[model samples]
Target: MSDIQDRHDSGGSGAGCGCLAVALLLAVVAVLLGRPFLTDDGDGGAQAAPEESVVATPTSERPRSKKPSGRRPGVVNIFTEQGLRGVRAAGTGIVVDPSGLVLTNNHVIQGATEIEGTDTDDRRTYPAQVLGYQKSGDIALIRLSGASGLKTAKFAEKWEVRLGDVVTAVGNAGGKGGTPSVVTGKVTALDRQITATDQSDGSSERLTGLIETNAPIKPGDSGGPLLNTSGQVIGMNTAASAGFDLEKKGASRGFAIPSAKALEIVRQIQRGEASDTVHIGRTALLGVQVRQPTTPSGGRAGGAYIADLIPGTPAEQAGLRARTTIVALDDEPVDSPGSLTDMLLRHHPGDTVRITWTNAAGERRTTPVTLGDGPPQ
Candidate 1:
């Protein structure tokens, strides 16, 4: 290396030193071999280069060029009643069913001006039909007029949506009528309930089953989408910058209802029944916050364990106590908390439910009782 440098400095007459050419080959070999020995960006004090990230993307098997922008389809611009009045308070919604059932937030269409849906190509505008809506779940169902051959949004399973996953929201943030917009963020939290006042009254309503995220949701972005890394619909954007009591000091703490529950409301609307929204005087509330058990078995180790039961809830009223294990519902054994909730949700609040379980003492116990108010967001 020294000989090459000396020859180059001396400006050797023999068509530039041959040593320089040899040294150049050796230098190229050193770079090729040195890279493997060096630590990656985080471990090493120095980084390869900012553009290296861009360059590396091309070499990836699933190259960046092949990645879809999620701009092809499965997105529609939502027009509300407010739009007629030139109010920019509308939100976005996604088609989840072949029959044109759309899922969005309850507040999005609470006072809709005129319901309209526009596909990626904004040139096509169709009058949307509002089938029904459940304010409690922040879910509503709507369909495009004679929407045949429409692309449906793909739904991501719960296991697929992990915290810290990259997500994006596509909606009309400015609610600029036909044109739609987009926002991107990360999944920051989940299973959150925010007690905050809605539009009008002083009282606050609790939003539940919410997957919290930092998605930049604006006023008109409600009922939009919370798409996973793969751009699959995972949740419906509800509220953001919610001034709730618990997390009052919050910013971009947007909340969304998971796709699992949102699909229920969407199905109701597609059915085209006026009363698709099942209104009940009082629904069953287990009043217990439980986690899904790890295994399925004969004893309490595998079933729903009462995490916290309201003092005078339906379960409590029926002699259901704290620390009690829920082994079976009706006659089927419940293997996990999800099973118990699923079973309980099947029945209305006033509906009768038979809970059979083996107490901590191994004594079999059965309690028959009516359900209470459900957890309505």
Candidate 2:
């Protein structure tokens, strides 16, 4: 997790400066609690980076432990390599079915070209493929190859959760591959809402009806189980407050998506119901990075400006180039990069769509391009 930096006034009286500093210190930054492990080259290739160490120091008198634990039959560590930028990310997942159906956060495997899972039960690594995902709800389902007879996670039957209930969170903290980390705390609130921002692009999404707890859930814990006293999962850990001092007691707080809501989305995905927010299969790629362009007066332009195009992709083969603006897709207006992504999600590989763009010469051009199979967007 990274801090959301805020600019503060430098000039002030000593007492006023002290007050402002205190206010800044108390401000909470909600961040998605997952660790991305690899850096990206300018082109779409991964460059190896040093692994991040776990933050194991306790924040309270009742210390959280990072020691290796016994086999967690249902939990697995997930590793993903993104297709476009070649960045690798790590997170936790829970087995929902014996046939290796895993449930995790959408952001954990988003844009992944390859996925692998290491089951804690047997410490065996297996290849994985995305089944479906609901981007709006931040939920996703994946299947591990050649896996069977695995233990499935136990869900609370009644789905009853209350404030002050003792709970434990288990996950692959710091992207460490082995026995997951364990942290215990109490549920502090329910039906909470938080704005989760992607550190890479600063894009944000609102997560509502969350279960808030005082657990020290750290990076790499996303999609792990938030269990009750009986060890039945009640929620899935998702986000947490960033930049908490390790020595400060009770300074950390975590948020989770309730299991009931997550399961609902999972069932929808299993049924192959593709909605406005749910994508049924692998993403279709236009293969161009886009940004908002600026006019001569320094105002935002109307269309998505092409930043770069991947080699041998649909956009490149169709003669799209950097510095142009994509105005429409299949006659649908593309006002921004997000709009273009949303439109692409509605289509699949082999689906041909007409694209309209404005070149550097100010000439508008239209062409039909067949979409290609790509990683999740």
Candidate 3:
């Protein structure tokens, strides 16, 4: 008994918090899937929002609905595999429309060369294609054919969330790996800020203005929904580091990037721009860490300035000097931190760009930088 007790004592508790990840949270409420509960700034955001408009191929172009239902099945699954012969890594997705617009966590479908979904009716899993994905925000959308009777998940306005409210989180928790599961919890925070970790390498992704709940989440829950009492989804539960304990789970924990931001990404995919969309692997995927710069004109109140650039990142490769004041990316001018982060993540690595900036010496410079592929380690 003493020896067993000694080992238990030595085992101890770990509070490393995954040694600090810059990643954002992904909630995967397995089994059936539930929904929960569910911001930002300038130039980057400005460019990102306007250019995005989700376009779903009209169902009229596809075969007729076999079993017409009042509510379309709103959720589907994204499948991935270690190799062609490896065990498939599949996660849940929410159907956004009858035309088969689907929303899921970026991580859930990260390496998937293809994705597919099935409804309650034993409909065969149909082929899925990435419509568009924004890793910084932990969101992605896919397109499917031959899907009908799809139930669209209802969304709550961002302002509708309140603290202490009960919520249900649903997704495929254990995976083909296991069956889907659902967990219940309450809103511990509204507009919480927390960093998520990359499942691939355990790097950190800073996600801000997110929802928090004292709920248990696991690997298969990556792309699930956080549903309110009314069964309306206010936020897409993206992630939480597995290392956190019961105590740390609440205070300053878990994150759900809001639906408003998701609306932008979903719209962009619907517009036929989905095929070439980039998945930069979340966090400040921009490769540039920045702060809001004070301006002479008080322009935009919180204009953004590049603070640090990752080596070999698009920003660094672009010849963008650290601490430079970025006035624009492509044709859109950046005025806020969130905007800049979103804008940079919107473009994939190796993509070309026209960047205009003001150097510390007050010299106006235009440098062309090609976006790099993959995230900074």
Q: Highest TM-score: which candidate?
A: 2
lDDT of 1 by residue, 171-270 (tens): 6554554445666767665555555342211223455546666665655566777776567676777664222211324645566677777776566555
lDDT tens digits, residue span 194-227, model 3: 5543332223455655666666654445566777
| Candidate with better lDDT, 2 vs 3 | 2
Candidate order, TM-score descending: 2, 3, 1
For model 2, the stretches where C-alpha displacement exceeds 4 angstroms are 1-72, 198-203, 240-250
TM-score-better candidate, 2 vs 3: 2
> Which parts of model 3 have CA positions greater than 4 angstroms off?
1-73, 82-87, 120-123, 157-159, 177-179, 198-203, 241-254, 272-377
Per residue, candidate 2 scores C-alpha lDDT tens digits across 103-153 of: 998867766688888888877788999999876677999999999988888
Task: Quote the RMSD, in angstroms, for model 1.
Answer: 23.9
Q: How much is the lDDT of residue 42 in candidate 3?
A: 14
User: What is every candidate's alpha-carbon RMSD to the true fold?
Assistant: 23.9, 13.4, 13.4
